[model samples]
Target chain A: MTTEFATRHLRRIRLVLWGVVTAVLLATGGALMMRSYLLPPTSEGISVEVATIGETDIRSEFTLMDHTGRAVTEADFTGRWQLVFFGFTHCPDICPTTLAYMASVLDLLGPDAERVVPLFITVDPARDTVPVMAEYVAAFHPRLVGLTGTEAQVAEAARNFRIWYERMDDENAPDGHMMAHAGHMYLMRPDGRFDDVFQEQDQSPQKMAGQVLARIQESQDVK
Target chain B: MRVLIVAALAVMLPLAAHAEVVVTDPWARASILASRPGAAYVTAESDEDDRLIGASTPIADRVMIHAIETDANGIGRMVHRKTLDLPAGEAVDFAPGGMHLMLMGLSEKLVEGTTFPLTLHFEAAGEVTVNVPVLGVAASRLDEGSK
Candidate 1:
């Protein structure tokens, strides 16, 4: 009887230990879930936010001429998707490459490309006049629009877009003048609001088209 | 089990295709434009070798290497040179407004989404072939990595 009683006591102890172990495991799992769910941005660590620049809050005012010297304003970008690339006509490579990519993107998108307007905003207004821009842009895609303004207006537009441009002089330059301009593209929504921004590097026509298609779809769903 | 096998194959195929270059941070490439002369660009490794030798395209007349020269005043001038050497893996870049390959005249225009065959003759690595997929004509400035 004493042996049986001892055996029962040991069984009860073992059962209690097992129950405690299971409860601890469950509690640990629950705490981990809670921690992950409440994961907050650390103050010391590098923090990044999506669309954190909030550049859309600012609006760029441009008193510029289109490719044909037609007076254009920020309102021209409204009611249609516009892709604005900042550069100069003297930029033999980047400017042309970007326009060509946009042309391809337009072609790939087919009819939908019509709703998407492509604009080349020149930082070098001295060299890239309305006519020169028209011709330079025509070499890439006919549908692409080119915009140029007074240095002041151009600078204002660039500032709104958070782009930088400066003129560098070259004593030995064949023309004795130079313009080192910023290179990037911004996507303005149909309402003239800044929607997306693309880098100067690491982009393909397929990727661009894919992004446009996806964004268009997403926007449609939201509407 | 079957779905898992197929998914593995799908991932492996493209990786095998791009086994040549990882392009982790970023690397630049341009499509061999069709219907005209050819051009080439590089996504350079800034910290590594910065030397380039010769660039060749199967569709081009000849691969002429060139880089842009910007004087103190910020004027950019294109100077054609024979070799751009990247020493000890120092990254030499060939992006717009800086160092680049002036792909003289092309046999055709470089259209987007098309991959062009380019042979790069590096000073150290001998010869490496890169499939340059063209981006856009006006999109030429290539800055890689987080600046």
Candidate 2:
């Protein structure tokens, strides 16, 4: 072959390779720009994308007995927002205090309380029987519902909620034992999806109510 | 003679310094269906500094002092308190969500409307007994504030 023809072929191959590299670089830059747009950098300079990528929606369902000994399930919590707490009636401090605080929050919501249901699910089912729950709940808000089921049923509900609770046996305890459980309140959406969780300790009723109402309003805006 | 006088003064000093522990609005939550644990709250004050070492009630097998606190995991748990400081001229309130006298193993049901005897033991004030009215389970410090 002639030297001129060989040089022309080599230049053409080099030009084609350069074009491919430029196109690949432009495509990658565009994709990264789109991702940055979707997830803005938080104050910590870390995009929420990394956090959301590993997060899976929590869909939990369980059948339990209410204080009245009536059978209820997750379906019963439909059509309204549910604020569920896991605790026992014998819980001298946190349980009643949390209930009272939640009641105050619901009261502050006023008529809006109708749209929310406060639930107290006992982690110590062995002691918190139906009658015990009935009296225990009546002491709190009228809108509060106390639920206690069999050991297996309670365990299933706790598992679905992904909460940790263990019966701490104290020989000196008045009830013969105590249940050490998570103290966060779970806020569930009308469609039975996990919405938000609130820590009851040291949090005022008004602030918690504001957070809950804001979330509900945000959810409504999305719809 | 000076030694005798000092000895007498020493004996009378405790009685002279026996600051009165005033317990007001003393109340307790009525027991629910079964005889479970209950808590009693009171506003205590003294003319001089005193420490509430312990509390007791005839209705319970034993009375305990407990404070509700959030642990490292942010979970609320009850911690037994050995003593509560009460400064002079300042009222210390044992209210819900804070410190309270836990009545364990009630001898009788703390029914609403009934009154039970609660004795408060202080370091310098000796023992002061008060009748704690049993209010409904929903009663709290705010409820007493209205009255």
Against the true two-chain complex, what DockQ does each candidate achieve? 0.13, 0.14
Which one is best on lDDT?
A: 2
Model 2 chain A poorest 10 in a row by lDDT: A46-55
Taking all chains together, each candidate's TM-score versus the true structure is 0.51, 0.70
lDDT of each residue in B1-147, candidate 2, tens digit only: 999999999999978766888989888877765566788888999999999998888888778787655657545455667788889999998887677788877888888888999999999998999998888665656474235
- Please report how far candidate 1 places residue A211 from its true position, in Å: 1.1
Tell me the TM-score of model 1.
Answer: 0.51
Tens-digit per-residue lDDT, A19-112, candidate 1: 9999999999998865543333221111111111245554545778898989988786677788878876544455556677777788888778
- TM-scores (chain A) of the candidates: 0.68, 0.69
